[model samples]
Target: ARNAGIERATSEWIAFLDSDDYYWPEGLSTLRLVATLTGASIVCGMLSDADPGRLVPEELQVSIADQFLAVMAFRGVVPPLSMSSSAIRRDVVDTVGTFSRSHGTAEDREFWIRAAARFPVGIAFRPVAHYRIDHGHGKNDAHFASGAKLYVLRRIFREVIQNPVVEARLRSDPASDVFYRLHQSHLLCLDAAIRIRAGEMISAASTLSDAAVLCHTADELYCLIRELAYFLTFPRSDPYAATLRCSRWLVTLARETARSGDRRLTDALLVRASDAIYYTARQLRRSCGEQLAWRTVIAGLRVVPTIRSAKSFLRFLAESPRHTGHSLMYPRNQRG
Candidate 1:
């Protein structure tokens, strides 16, 4: 395959393209600019799913250390096979070797992993390619497989251990490692609950037990306990009733926290409480046969002055991130 391509190629640079893919106008120009400025051997660009689309922009690291850390922190997760989105120097390929055909499902991801480790990689932040997201004929499952998340976590653990740059950073900020592990564990728990909701109780319990191992702090434990309570009562109770009860609990908690006179805490709690109510309203809107806009929710909120510490919480909640992405199971897990 390499010989065939090399014989026909006349260009100084080479880029990849799969049968069904194509590039945007600005993509190659962005890659060319980066290569010219940095003398980079490889350039990675952004890719969008052929259907719904990507959640984040194409990310790059200023240094190998930063790259290593980000990849490790997020676990050894790789993007989909859309290597054609990137452009590479022909000389770089000559030195590093051609792509491997061995990977059955994730060939492109494997290629980039090797490339980034071997050479200076420039990034073009512009979205370039359209990727075909196979839906498996409407039996589409977006959640990670049984052990896939854990598998990636373990791989990231190994990579960081091997990379001196990442190891030093972890040693310098030991809490960061704890924080990552805590998040990984929390996701595992959330996945378990979602599986249970999808009718996989045995798997849920097994996964939750594994997640319990990652719990390190009382706050972490508290979050899991609350989630457990919610899940346990979820099936038996009406969804609206559950949402209302949870909203009331959150509101009471925020009110009590506000009474303590800690301005930041008061605002934070209020924002969280209001956001919870807002989300519940969204879920209930369809079930209750009513549609709501953000403006409506805000208009209906009790009057609270933005100038006051507690009042800011309500305002913050009103402007909180919404329709941004899927909400993780335990909102508290978002913070350290």
Candidate 2:
């Protein structure tokens, strides 16, 4: 239906807006001005979640040298350039083709990936669109469920990773290696989350290990560790099993980071893994009052850097007595 509309439209430039989202009064004008000035095939404007309550800023055009990297950084979780917030030169669409129904709910994402890969993408840093957060159960909500989200992510990964054009582009540039790793890591994390939610503990652990290998930055490693903690701590099935799997993966990841000579990341992973073990043990004690010896937990704690250990000790002391009871009750298992 959207493709048909695009085909029939007479305009040289195209913009889209769904029924649930709206553009600010000046959105079209701002986009047109940006496209005119930058000559970019695609122009994206700043998107806001709520009303600006003030006049939109003057259009500030910025060139995106690496469209894939720029879009990945800008969009984060959401699709890059929501339909309501971007305008595209018609010829680019004609050349790259329109949205594909086969990609399912990730059509916008796939389209943006193709467009960005093929042409320059410009940003207009003025709030030109407001993407309303719908509370109702809509089509989008259904697509956000575990099965649907996983399917979309897998499709996106296959499309981006398997595309010969993207592969060639990355191989041509030495600086693109990090970005490629970052992209792969991001997809692996998403896949791992879905697997964890489905109670595929071992598979999740393996996927996370792959993600950890690609993580060069502390921030990336920390984010991945936090996701692991969240899913393992709040497992849908067996929390103990989830925690055990996560603890093992984190210990392995810590060793890898240490080998990479990233002390901060290594320490952070150790701290996170220890916390997972500590919480899991506490949960076990509370639920079954059964003491389980874990060599992995001790190994993680034994390797914690001195500075990180001091911080962990201070944090533990600040917690309530009930929170610290589990650690104190159990004989600390010693291993490295």
The candidate scoring highest on TM-score is 2
In terms of lDDT, the poorest run of 10 residues in model 1 is: 135-144
Those runs of model 1 whose alpha carbons end farther than 4 Å from true positions after fitting are 1-10, 49-81, 91-96, 132-201, 208-336
lDDT of 2 by residue, 50-108 (tens): 45553446646555444765444322332247678888889877777888887567688
lDDT per prediction? 0.47, 0.63
Tens-digit lDDT string for candidate 1 (1-336): 543674578898777776445666555776677678667777666675432232344453321122322222233212321466767777766754555554223334434544444455666555666544221311111212332333343344334344443344456764666646765775675566466556565566566656655765545544553443343222112434444443444344335434544344344434444544455445334323233323324432542223342453345344544434323211332322
Best by lDDT: 2
Q: Output the lDDT of residue 183, model 1.
A: 53
Worst lDDT run of 10 residues, candidate 2, spans 70-79
Clashes per candidate (backbone, < 3 Å): 0, 0
**Would you estimate the TM-scores of all the predictions?**
0.40, 0.62
Model 2: lDDT equals: 0.63
Candidate 2 C-alpha error for residue 133, in Å: 1.4
